[model samples]
Target chain A: MLAVLVGSGAMAQEIPAEPAIETAPEPEPIPEPPPVLHPPRNIVAQDVPHDNGGVLNIQWEPPIEGVPVRYVLEMAGEDGFFQEVTRTALTQYTVMQLENFVPYRFRVAAVYEKGQSMSPETEPVMARDHWLKLGEMPVLIAIFVFGSLLLFFIQAARRGVELFVRRISGLTAVEDAIGRATEMGKPVLYVPGTSTIEDVATLASLNILGEVARRTVHYDVKIICPNKDPIVYTIAREIVKETYASEGRPDAFDPDSVFFMVPDQFAFAAGVDGIMVREQPATIFLMGMFWAESLIMAETGASTGAIQIAGTDSVAQLPFFITACDYTLIGEELYAASAYLGREPMLLGTLKAQDYGKLVFLIIMVVFTLISVFSGYDAASLVRVR
Target chain B: MKRRFPMTIMFLFAIWGGISVFVGKTKVHDFDNLLRNKLLLIVGAFAIILGLGSLIFHHTQKIKRKARFWQYSYVTLIALAVTTFIGLGGGVRGERSLPTIFGGTVIGAHDGLVYVFTSQAEKNLFMDEPSRYADPTKAVLELPREFETDFNRFEASQLREEIHLKHTALQLKGQPIPPMISPVSNQQVAYKKEFKISLQQLYEGILVPCGSTMFAMLAFYMCSAAYRAFRMRNLHAGVLLVAAFIVMLGQIPLATAFIPGLHELRQWILDVPNLASKRGIMIGVGLGASATSFKIILGIERAWLGGGE
Candidate 1:
């Protein structure tokens, strides 16, 4: 029985071959060949205008025959092999990074799924650099007119011609603020803005600082100037030292007075605020390029009961300075402050030129507005800068 | 002559700047970019040396003199030293090593199994879920990428082979079944190959929070400024107050639900009057900046030359 069971098991384990069933294979569908496409026509390649050289603008009309998936832009040097520059679906493409003043030829290839056809090669063209950007003619003309007026006024002032000047209350208050600080026996805190020398506002603030330094020396008042930029720190130190020498009191210029605070924005604001709260300065000068921290510093100064005078060319910061400070220099007033205080003929002449420039700009705005309203034309395009 | 020499160079560069703006030449732009980027950056880098010297000198003097708040100077100096050391020695996210001891055990049988950990936090993390981090069949711990360091890193196949060999050896011993982690050995060699707290971590953990706190203070300051400026004292103040009120009201959904026209009124106020005034200031500022640049280039504004007329 055991042998019978073993034999049956072996028989069960033995593989049985099933009868093979034959079947016909389904017919495969043949793929149709892609239609031929013609290359673009009237291909024009020229140097881009009013830009640095080594760039060419290529444009073409669509092909008359079948459309292509994309057009391949190929370029070659005078004798170099053709290389694919770029592929574009549009009719126009800007070829860049070519050698200036070197003639090059370009061709367009209409690329299809199966095949591609090349357009006739364009004439050899060289990218030329323009000496003057003609697209900036409007700006150049305006600069010329304004600059000529400045030169004329500067020349006139150099000849000792008396020019009428207006009085700015903010400039007049500088002396009083210094006197107030002197009487209080507290230091005058001067923040020459939390910006680098690259900003003109900081330069203007430094210019104003020189005059303020001179006055502080004359009045025997202590001045605490904190800086945020390393370069500005060096310049401010020199200005203060020079101002002391010019005022015949070199000993009073403390080397540590014009110190550098942290260069961070909010950190500088917090440091200045801490100084305001601790030192309790009698007067604070917030001048230079300021962003969101303007209000924080100004309000802190206000809380300290310090006489604050803020000036900034940053239009967004003007409202903050105006609200928190006792005296605020608005818009162009900050730039005019140095001249207003110095009373130098050349500086005053430049200030007058700036006013004239504004007048001319106003007239231009009026004329443009009239043209836009009457002629229904966008005259802004004429002066629009690229 | 000291000032005149610098002014002469400044004059040349200024003229070059003005001319370069209108010259569409690649060489000119290249030179201009070189001066603006490379030259300025090199000088700025050197200036950092001067800044560090000044900072160190200022703090040293304060500590020597026992000046006001002199205790704070020590803190500043210590912080500076620590930050510099960490910044230079250990790069922002550079690695550091530490010893690690692996410990775990299965508590109960079936799917309700728990992992016995040395620390309570780790125990709670893997409680009643041994399969969450470790595979019973695989006999390997699946550590998160952030937690897995070079010393602890093991290839899956290699670790499985090692664990399998150990498991088979234990099984052949004919002893009672051992714990999941005990089978791998109590003290597995692991040298922590990465720092858990790096300079970047310090910056994000400390400086970022401080900066955020400072920035958050702006809201209070803005409120104070607005409250003071919006007082009904003069015509301008009244106008500002009303405009601010309208804008504030328009920003809220409840006010708009009451009067939909308030939104349009707010839009007109912002788009027309506010934008017009902003543009006026912008134009004035632009002209003023241009004039200042011209003056500086012409040497009419000599204050920037370190205080010479």
Candidate 2:
């Protein structure tokens, strides 16, 4: 502001000397200087919530008129260490890295033409870390609700409660896919996904493979599972061996049935395609997570006139499998296939609990939608996940 | 307890992973980085080494037994062995110390012979000129001269060094025959690498071609599958055929140019029904995965531990 006055004074030198009319020299009364703007109102400082600590937030309401050119905020703690944190036009400032346990005061001032006004120092506030963050309330609610429902269903099943789940045709045809291979005197090819065992989709595939192996052992059908991940291949071998043994067909289990191919994505796909072309299997089961290779395996199987059954959690690959395979279990159907096939109470009860959780989620969504329509408040915003 | 032990570890680790997300930009972030980048690599390295070992053992057994297609096993084994040796000996970037077999004769780069060189401008490479030379030969450059006559890099390098030295000196003295011209810039400099069989060369020449060939096969498969799938066997197949036709046509600018609103229709179809269905499947998949994870964490699912055993 002082710079603005000095700039105006320099411009006076550019003007021609006021003519002799200035000789009249009638001295005039000096105009009064402009009034200074008042400082902001209702200054408050509080601890920033839902954090690990060492932060405080300060807010103030600007005066209705005569606003300042800018606002300056400062903070002070023990030892009277007051220092300007930052200067900005915003009405609120968050002072960070304050001493965790020490109280701190904040002052906000407004700068005007030639003067400034400072608000009274805010009541000292201390930053503290809370054990639990309130920002995660929605997440906590979801977990608690879903987990409780799951536990409840598990207890109910332990008490001999019966559960009913509609049959998924894709799983029902697992026997047909295996039996066709047996009748045709060809091996049943099973690719338990090209991904590592760490992926949940691959784990889901393994669970279904167990049931398929048991059925194959009972029917005396040959089942060959090729894997791309070494750990998955080893565990698949174990699962097949145990399946045959438990079904009293130990001799039927072949260790070479579940083998590891090269770990390269396209290499695995080419190897599997070669297996499809050469072996000409009666049926191929492609399950788990796949990328670009999904269609390669499925289309090769289709061309060989083999019955292809594919199930994967990869949404992008689902279209390819649906286009080329005889039966493609879409999305959640793949995950649910294991429980549907085995019908074990442990699996069935979880499916039941998941249905209940979905119901609650549906109700919540419906309620939020209606509230937003009638009350004009976005209730769904309360459930922001991240 | 055999099953419970791994489950307990998984549960604790999952909980810690969840908690780490909320800590947000704190010291825990450093720990997360350490675990993800360092610890995971340590574990993955062992898994990969064991996997390679198994691959070697598997192929050798196939060869010993004379299994069907056993000849292909030899190819895989030889390729694996050669690549491993080359990768370990000739480093990924060819930085490993293997003795240079050929003389270090770089064709374009400075190799101790000089002739009149081109500076592209008068007097010097930069700044104002001292004086314009009527005959550029009077300047007498001290830099590497470009090979104006066609000379094979391999052939030239094999020639005796004295031949190039004697010829370069004569050319610098303004001899009418065998004119020496220098490259205008670095872009014009052409040099053959000293080592021919580099790791990157093998990867680009062999691995990339094979991978690309496999990926290219998808084009044929896609066409054949489309033929079978769009058979018009039912209403659903007919709908798919029509939708596929429009989407494919909309992708071509010529088709959309003939139909003014075709692009808008394509965008609406993608952004509306296609995205809606995709997101719907995503949500269902998410829920199923969540349920499955919970089952695994609570020990309700145990097939991963070798079935019911």
Candidate 3:
């Protein structure tokens, strides 16, 4: 019985030791020491000027060790303690607004989840406030060229130098259209367009109107103007009156013919259409800054069997005018038409100078296109060398 | 001589106004209060009278002569009388009250005009079925009764009807319903019609009709005008004819489709030779305009201001 009691006590002690052993299984195999991360390679630095004094640019390639790694770009000043600029998965970083003309040392380190490896510091790049230095030369060159051209033209115009101007088909047709109306014994309808007087297009229209008035006075043709702007209406009456007086036909001029239509665009268009349909004008002159109403007006004139001559600077709407009108002035040509018809010396000189400017533009475009084409072929090699 | 001196002064003022941009450094904020000042309000009030006067003079002449489409004059006269009566009869602190019947009528008409011409017109013309009203006659009959309830209630009910119609139409047309309400009104109202007509309405109702009519009318006028003007019995006319034919055919889609080369040719004409010529002309125009502007600024181009020789 004493022997049995001692065996029972030893068995209980062995059972407790077995429970402790079962609680802790083999420890995780020490996690394989996590693949060693090499530092980022070929670090480079450059100076960039910005509004503030706390930025720099750092660039580097991924580590050659072929491990997945991110980079941390760190910058330091003369104080020597590095502050992280950016933590990025990218190979490039632009450190911005660094202290002006101050030296900054930047380095990149490769990091894995386990640990980080250091890269060699890039050559110290100075932050500069001299940003204007880069852009100044090109801007100066452009200003000089543009200013000189402007001055030359102005001086030439002031000196009364004769400038050659090309004839616009639409302007040339103006007198003919008016004459045709005179022959048909029908009134001429002139719409200065639907834009407000503040628009430059309206000014061009007025200039053209002066020419049309001059012709109408000479031919003794009745000209009816339907205007959208009250200001334009007032101006039209004055212009027409002056033209008639200048042509020695002031008595023949009818102030009532210059009428003010509604201020609304569509209302004005409808009113003008009513005039076209009712009056059946032998000729219609649509000159000004027109919108979608251009096609409507042109088409209405076409239907009325009027000799339509439309001129506008709206490029998108030019196609409709071209299709419907006898002669259409495209874009800048409207401006040119007025100048040609007006025959003012200042205008002629400016026209000649602008032609030379356009020639310069054409040459530049051609050279740039050719260079772009040639450079595209070997761009990869050039990029590698850089 | 008295008129001439004041006119000259006004001309000088205008010239100064054009050059004010170069001379003055005033910020837009400085002008904001001045834009809404009492003097400007007075001037605008007078300007409105002038506008009404012009409209009256024009329609009166048409009415007197019994001109073509003279019947339209009645509509113009009635519109003018109603607008003038509303505008002139009402005042802020006068015999007429701020919320006078005339004033309210004017405001209601303006708002109603936009809704009818914009929303209802589209529903009437383009919609497959009237969605808001299962029966439009019922909605029409209810309109007068709702309007008689109270001014505010009437406006609210009318607005609701517009909303219902707009939403239902959009739903029927398989379009998403648009949320419509006055920004001043806090209520979030879903409209029956999705399309709110604006410039598109003007395009459809006015510009399209005018343009199509103008285009068709030109054909008849051109026939007569061409018979007289296009006698290509001269060198200049011959050149014009050729140029016209080239441009006309070049612009048409049918020509471009049939002859692929014509498209390139047209582009060349527009971009190269045409652009070059146009530029040459523009330079002249720019110079002329600059000179004219300079003259105006210096009070030389005084003809516009009705001054000078």
Candidate 4:
């Protein structure tokens, strides 16, 4: 059976004895090649003035064939050194950071990723550090307008300008709270919010603390001041000490009364609560940077039946203080509290300037809003030098 | 003369400082580091030490007097002594040897305490065959290597044997283990594991809430104080009370739920009138700050350095 199988396999191999030849048909020649892209013509380079230096604007037109092509902008110094600035699919580019007052030759080339066609160089253009003559106009106008208004207000105040500031209820309550404490023969608790001395709010609190100390001294009422920051603690101590000294009641100044509680926020709050509960001061003064503790401190003080007056610049905590404190200074009023109490001329002048600036800002805002509403946001109309 | 001389010097320095910063003449980066890092950091570190000393002294005085809860003083003292000893030991065995030892001990003790309480609690609560509880061997094994290092193996093995014995005895008695028992033990193990994981998370999360918990909790105490302290008993209080009420009710969801109109009113209060008032105050503050900054720059505000007193 194996021999028969072998014989059959050999016969199968010998069955296709005739040799075969095969051939492939040639492909048709490619169609005519596409036209080449040519370089742009009429290249122009202009110096952009009023800049530090080395800036130029180059523009050109595409060849008449109008085949879509990208433009290459290049610049070379007088020393025949060159660098490609940009390869834009547009006809223009602003070349910058060129050497000032130095001559430069620029050329434009039409380019595709595959190839580039160069244009003849434009006549050498010199970039100059041109100081724009009219550049100072806007600043000058601004200075003049502001300076005149400042001078005008100064003179008006000199002529006894009747500036009417709205009454802040928080400020009005300070005296009442202090008076209540004095009436009760209980100590007035003053806490310059949990911020360092460098914080404006802390300084403002210090100023108000001075005023409170003055009043407390006059009333022969005890005052307790607690601080969260060591630096603020020192400042508060100094302010209170100086105020007492100034009042000629240096003996009344109690160092123990003004103590540094834990610098930690909640720990400070807890300590303050302990103080409020233990001391049961008739009135509590809070001013400075406060957060969630505003409500905690205020609520605790409220529970103690201690009149609480709080001031802070933390917008998020203001609502909490407002709810929990008898009187709460919101936002910038904490800043104004110091000026209102101290009546420092520099502070007062700055306050007046701020008011003036705000008035100007309001007017500008109104005008801008009206113009935007009417003009439908035309780019040309909104453009201004300043 | 003492005050005036300092004031004069401060005023000049403040002005100089302000001009330098505003004119961009002073390198802001260098100045910021000097003020924030060098000055503030040194002062803050010393202040922290003072705070620690005060805490220790106050507690020590309480202990000496044998005041209420004075026994807690021993706990604090032991902790302090142990921490100092370990810290000063300088990791003679290895850098992390002491920490690993202490940390492991704490973790093991915590787990032991949980196990004891939970097991006893289950037993007292009439939990049948509580030992048949879901085995937490895998979870226990999964505990951090550091924790396992100080784990009380004897205690763990004893507890396991006790549980196994109880379980086998209950099974032999043909009594089914109570659902609550097994779940509670499983939960205890899960809780222990979760605690460790959460501690890891606390150290890893964007904020370490542990450090800030004391500060954040003050909000609660403050709220209590405010309610008791703030009352519209007088004229000034009346105005403050009204504003406070508006602001408070306006902030919560209750106001919107009760009176839809109040939401708009609140918005107006915040966006318009409130913003206007805030801006007005801010403008004043800005000017004040400018003047102060000017003074500081000119060296008039030397209070920052605790000088010029």
Query: Which candidate number would show the highest DockQ if scored against the true structure?
Result: 1
Candidate 3 residue lDDT tens string, B1-309: 733674576566545443332221233213533543554466545654555566678788889889889889888788656544544553211123323211111012111122222333434432333233233311212222212222222343465565466556667999754343222221222222122223334345555675576556545645554454446878977865666667778999998889878878767777887787666555444443444444444332333432114
The candidate with the higher DockQ, 2 or 4, is: 2
Residues A1-386 of candidate 1 have per-residue lDDT tens digits of 99999999999885888899888888898887666668899999999887767889999988898888999999999786899999999999988888899999999999887789899999999898877787878889888998898898889899999888777787789999999999999999999998898898898899899888878998899898888888888889899988888777888888878887778788788878988987899999998899888998999999999999999988788888988999998878888888888889988898888888888989999999999999999999899876
What interface root-mean-square deviation (Å) does model 3 yield?
A: 7.8
Q: Is the docking of candidate 2 incorrect, acceptable, medium or high quality?
A: acceptable
Q: RMSDs, each prediction?
A: 12.3, 11.7, 13.8, 14.1
- Candidate 4 docking class: incorrect
- lDDT of the candidates, in the order given: 0.79, 0.75, 0.62, 0.63
Q: Return the TM-score for each candidate structure.
A: 0.77, 0.73, 0.53, 0.56
Worst 10 residues of 4 chain B by lDDT: B101-110
Model 3 C-alpha lDDT versus the unseen true structure: 0.62
- Candidate 1 per-residue lDDT, tens place, B1-309, comes to 888898899889888888899999878988999988899888888877777777777778878988777777788788788777777665554233322233333222223222233233333434435346353322234322222222223332344445566557657988544454232332331211111234664576567677678888889988899898999999989999999999999999999889969999999999999999888887778777877888888888877665545
How does the DockQ of candidate 2 come out? 0.29
Measured with C-alpha atoms, the lDDT of residue A46 in candidate 4 is 87
lDDT tens digits, residue span B1-309, model 2: 866787788788667666765664345656767776687677667766766766777678778888678788899889988887778776653446542332222222222232121221211321232222222322222223443222223223323343455556767987643443432222222122233234664676677789999999989888887888889999999988888788888999999999999999888888898898897788667767877878877777777666565
Worst 10 residues of 1 chain B by lDDT: B186-195
DockQ for each numbered candidate? 0.39, 0.29, 0.07, 0.10
Clashing residue pairs in candidate 1 are none
TM-score order, best first, reads 1, 2, 4, 3
